[model samples]
Target: MRLNRRLFLGNGAAAATTLAAPALLAEGGGKPRVIVIGGGAGGATAARYIAKDSKGAIDVTLIEPSRAYYTCFFSNLYIGGFREMDDLGHTYGALAANHGINVVHDWAIGVDRDAKAVSLADGASLSYDKLILSPGIDFVDGAVEGWSLSAQNAMPHAFKGGSQTELLKAQIASMPEGGIFAMVAPPNPFRCPPGPYERISMVAHSLKQTNPTAKIIVADPKAKFSKMALFQEGWLEHYPGMIDWIGEDFGGANVSVDPDAMTITIDGETTKVNVCNVIPAQKAGHIAEMAGVTGGNWAPINAEDMSSKADPDIHVLGDAADQGDMPKSGFAANSQAKVCANAVRGALTGSRVFPPKFTNTCWSLIDTDDGVKVGATYEVRDGRIAKVDGFISAPGESADLRRATFEESEGWYAGIVADMFS
Candidate 1:
């Protein structure tokens, strides 16, 4: 659950030695050391796969602040009362003991690309022959007026899946019978394109059971979203009276919020709500930007290998990388991590790294038994992320298929967690 002094010092020394002697391979012992920052979907997978496939030829050290991770992919189920925190929470001991990944429970504060090292908040530095960063997104200050990290204690986003989630869950639990719960959906190119709507659906489902008179409002910046028609159909058929979705045309769009007032304005009209969940537009993790790995909102990587354009020795995946045509979802992050792992291995071992095919599937539950999905397969071509042939979801499918897909989503989550920390 935590990194010991021996492991930390050993990892740091291994990283330095590996970088210092790039061409040397010790007889029967020495292997290239890889230091990965952030043990979420992308970083965890990269650490596991590289350790598995490379045998003892690669040493992987994963740095993350938390020992357990709660996935956003299934946290909406928690809101729907279909699951619990323990059901979704995953630990890193298996990654350390079984997969040979040295897990560091610490935060990375600075990245020195020139020295090929990462500085920790604890005044230690981790050197790396190759660094993989999948720190995910950070909320942009001032993007939403009057809402910052401190104010999040009162108005929880629950987007990152930690204490914020618990706070939001408690707020929902203690709401008055007829109270209004409002959610402000972020703009495009954010993590999980269909996440906000799916969250609303789950919240409304819960409200229907606990407080029949409670109202759920969604103030969305976008006119349309992923699986728009299907979500609307499900809401109308299931929780029609409980949900109200306001689009841009109806003065529902806003770029900012007033946290102190607990009010949000759109088109010169301010509305107050008992609970507010505001998801701000996102960009690559701060470390990536510090290392000059990103453009405006995301890092540009060579899609063939998920190698950073700024520095080939470092690979950036997940929501941080600008994978064209790929929606920023946990599925995408997991898929890209495997591709990056293989590439990292090949880069270190002098093996042939082939062009990889990537895939993503995002499933959203509208209610307990009803769900919708979107998926695509992709391949790198001409240095860009491109969708491959035969990549589509079965829309307007049979009820049996939808139910089966929901079940399959659960399986996929388990498989992905295995592919990462298991």
Candidate 2:
């Protein structure tokens, strides 16, 4: 249950108690300090768990640029008119007031691993005994030819949620009658493996209502995708003729776009389009590389405790981690964070540290009241996270089952935000 803000902040007594308990330090030993960067699923949950479980034993500070975070997981539904932008937004006030975390809304510009200090964009440097990084993803440059960040406004990727999602929604709403919308899907090893396909479904859902004559074309570099069979089947049933997916076999991999002309070329054929969403290949967030933790595009981590293989004092989580078996979804991040928190607290305070076990579930909304899911449980095997069991929703399932799945996703979204913030 969530505590009411009024009661929790009554006469500001509880707030004052929390204010005096948190310390921002790393030098001497009043309390062991922990610094976390990127306050999304992994970073926020880790900070919350460390502080709450320690019961003020640890001084936890979360350094995040954005005070309000927009989740990228179900952002496709916002395009389909199932949710509002505000629905996906969360703030960090509860993590500070309720969990005794020091939430710093500032960018982490540099990390001095030798000194165990992080330099913020605001010119302040802080030290910590342990550093946790979950900075998510940054796209590879020129991964999608003829497209760049400068042209993102003209041909929106909308993959990272927030303003880009709003831009895509507005562009979709403004499309001329019988217009064309094209998506150049990113290659594998990106955030949310099933995301681009789901976006296609949601776009089709929106156009079916507002502009039934409009069309969606996908240029995918891979022959198959996550939940390919289920999405294909759902498209055939709900959106018969609106989608055309061009796989790599047909030169989908050979593609380019023109933001100025609003056109896309596939298989040497150029056609004008009303909107083009280009999701480029991705890499770990720049901060990870800057910290000398990432060996390549992603930071390798130990499955036992989600600690960076390069530096055990630094842990990587969420989309930025190259963990085996587990998909880089929000659920996976939260699970990894808990394991990491338990391990870190044990290292700092000699608490009981349980062996790490992880799980992740990805839910995609195909159409109204129609949802599909894929998930797995994982454990350490041979020093890597290995799948123990798995489950996925089968095609041709009953309407009742699909609706229940969608409802489950809604509950999860609510619960996760509360878990992260409250």
Which candidate comes out best when scored by lDDT? 2
- Candidate 1 C-alpha lDDT tens digits along 214-323: 98878787888898888988888789788888887787665456778877776677777788888877889898888788888889999988889889988999999987
The residue pairs found clashing in candidate 1 are none
Model 2 ranges with Cα > 4 A deviation: 1-27
Model 1 global lDDT (CA atoms, 0 to 1): 0.80
- Local accuracy by lDDT, each model: 0.80, 0.88
Q: Tell me how candidate 2 scores on lDDT.
A: 0.88
Name the lDDT value of residue 196 in candidate 2: 93
Sequence-dependent TM-score of model 1: 0.91
TM-score, candidate 2, is: 0.93
* Segments of candidate 1 deviating more than 4 angstroms: 1-29, 389-397
